[model samples]
Target chain A: MNKKIKDEDIKVILNSMDFDIPSEIDAKVNEMIYSENLPAGFFKKLLRTSNPFIKWVPAFASILLLITLGLIQLNRNAPERKPLSEIKIEYELKDKNIKIIWVKKENFLLRRLKK
Target chain B: MTLPLFFAGEREITEKYSNKEVIISFNKFFIPEKKALYNFILKSVSFSEDSNDIYQNTALRAFKYFRKFDTSKRFKPWVFSIALNEIRKYFKNKIQSSDIHSIENSYEQIPDTQNRELAEAVYSAAYSLKNTEREIFFLFYDSGFNISEISEITGKTQGNIKVILSNARKRVKSFLGSKK
Candidate 1:
């Protein structure tokens, strides 16, 4: 019991199918191939001479490291500038120089604010 | 460069690679076939610009990898396999880049409007197919690659290629039907 479609149907469909080959593309193709050959040849030689780990692994590792370093630097630098405590300042008359204080308590306020 | 004694056909590869005549001959072998290979890839991907890129890259890949290729076997399929690999790579890149060229359209669809409207429409429709199905479709029917040859080119089992082709035929017919 075969259920294949009609041959005529296939012919109709296939006939309607058309392929376009742009003439301008030929020159471009030639250029692309020549250009590709240079890189491929270079890479092939590089692969042959270079250590496998150095060839494939280090590139990825370097990228991962850059990303890791970027994130670490981001974390370390961004959050630390906004400190939690209100200002606590102290001033004293020492060596004939006046120093003032500013802090949490009201009595500590003069110590905190008497700058 | 470390010259290895073990590249079994290193002599042939090196000889042909260095000799301008052999390289030219190898290129000549591809010149006539270029249009056909171009058509095979173009019909599936159906981008005029990308087709050219694929064709050129395929040729370069074929040239570079010709050494690992079996010298005794017919060169067309071997070289085409290399081209096909490059085309897949091209599509992978296209997909990665978020390009609008779809791997989902039918093989028969082409660009809209112009003297080549119908032709382009059909071509674009074919271009719309999934990458796998389109490849098998074009390889088997358009490029006249047989099942085994396509399997060899694609690294799929012949049975798997047959199934893909079956699905492609169905999808193409339906796509054409909706257009009508």
Candidate 2:
């Protein structure tokens, strides 16, 4: 099947395909190039300017600082008081502010009987 | 040698810069190749608007990546690779955004112009081919790249390119012949 269409026929078809680029198209391209307001020294400027360290570094440092502060606060606020079973506490309201009164059961009964 | 000299010395530095220097130096370094690139892209895409967009994208991409370019190599193929990428991107986007029904409906309303009618005929002929065959035939024959270069671009062996082109030519001939 391929043998029937000679080489010349393919050449003719290829030649028939026109590649006419119109002038207005070129004008449009030229207009775009002219209109582009690229930054001064776009390439040299890009290569010369180093990226900011603070963008990632500051963010990382702040996160570490927050975690450290949280850990310190957690340790400081932890309870260190002795267990309530060892020394019993009774509350007495004398003058609006409450006071802690330590009580032993035997001593309190003897004093109450004499009174 | 002379071309390199034109690109190597003071002209090279001036053209390489992107400020007013590029616009001024374009009259020399860029203008001569502009028409050829435009024509190449136009034929490659076969649509005025798409061709123009591809052309602009190719130029901008080429300019941006120019620093990485091997100056010793020919610039035409390098720029062409970019243009081909842009065209591929356009089609991929069209497929992504447009539904199949819309495409079929749009085809029914194809405008009546001589060039458009001829374009429709050629496109229908090309569409009947297998994907690989159509790609190789259009890229090599219609877009005017030789078989060796098409092999390089498509990463196919020369023998494979020949087989694809042979099969594609037969399909296109039959498709066109059936119409008559």
Question: Proportion of native contacts found in each model?
Answer: 0.11, 0.14
| lDDT values, one for every candidate | 0.64, 0.61
Each model's Cα RMSD: 16.6, 13.7
| lDDT score at residue A20, model 2, on the 0-100 scale | 52
Worst 10 residues of 1 chain B by lDDT: B4-13
> Candidate 1 on B1-180: residue-level lDDT in tens?
543423323343354355355457667677777767776776656644567678767877676554445556777788778778888888788779887555444433443434244444345555667888877777776677789988888899999998998887777666666666
- In candidate 1 the C-alpha lDDT for residue B53 amounts to 71
Provide backbone clash counts, one per model: 35, 0
lDDT of 1 by residue, A41-80 (tens): 5535633533333355678998999999999988885545
Clashing pairs in 2: none
Candidate 1 TM-score to native: 0.58
Judge candidate 1 at residue A19 and give its lDDT.
52
What lDDT score is found at residue A111 in candidate 1? 70
